[model samples]
Target: ATPSRPASGSASPARTSAKPARTSAAPEPARIPGPGYDSSADAQKQIEAALRAAKADGRAVLLDFGANWCGNCKAADKVFAQPQTAGILGASYHLVKIDIGGNSSANSALLRKYSPSGGTYTMPVLVVVSSSGTVRTDTHVTGNPSLTADGINAFLRKWAS
Candidate 1:
């Protein structure tokens, strides 16, 4: 599961002076490290970079589309974190977590562009793409997030080689 990283503002304390005159503080949500990635457009850039990096190493582009608040996605992450899954993913794919809701407009657009036509599906949409930016296969494995690790590896092996 993704850790709730400290917000950038909370990472360090503010410098204070010797004489204290006023005291006023407000509450704010904790800043997470990987939460706010530039913007949706910027996220696409990162995904593109990931794809290019994969092409450089002769690996497949593994697009993992899910929102940050998705419980299924979190569980999927754990399954994907397993030793065997990690080994294969690390060896032959660009495992990218593309957010689908909240501020992830670009990610949602990408999903609609390639996946179903009527509406969006549940979290953890596992899509496989080629180096030429062509989508090979698409599957929604959020039903059994934990069971998707094996399925994901199988997909990569099928196309990566």
Candidate 2:
């Protein structure tokens, strides 16, 4: 006789097995530094250093512009630090965070160089630049909605290569 199906709401008997099912825990997300707007005159020096490193590594530069006080910026940082996203970023790009200050003028001149409007006017702006210092992804004019995990992953996938 065939075994009968369990009732709609009844609990099924637990089967005993010598070996337990193998399960692996998910990896912890990467933790990045909190945003702090840099106001030093040598900010450009720091950027140049990152660009050089990107060139040496044959990777692109991922410039993140925001202040520590911005909630959206913090959220974007967290999403970038997630394991899957971090791996892609770590392998393909050199990351740099530039604080644009509360008024968005802390690094206005430097920011204008990459922005289409030639202005440092947006918070949480992400710009991808090639090792040769050419802009790859310009988020200034059209704006990018990559603050969320899905959007960020898609953006990285599109530019990381």
**Where is model 1 poorest over a 10-residue stretch in terms of lDDT?**
28-37
Candidate 1 clash total? 2
**Residue by residue across 29-82, what tens digits does model 2's lDDT show?**
223334455545355776798788877767778878777788888888888778
Supply candidate 1's per-residue lDDT for 98. 72
Estimate the lDDT of model 2.
Answer: 0.70
User: How many steric overlaps are in each model, in order?
Assistant: 2, 0
Instruction: For each candidate in the order shown, give its overall lDDT on alpha carbons.
Output: 0.61, 0.70
- Cα RMSD to the true fold for all candidates: 16.2, 10.6
**Candidate 2 clash pair list:** none
- Among all windows of 10 consecutive residues in model 2, the one with the lowest summed lDDT is 14-23
The collision pairs in model 1 are 6-31, 7-31
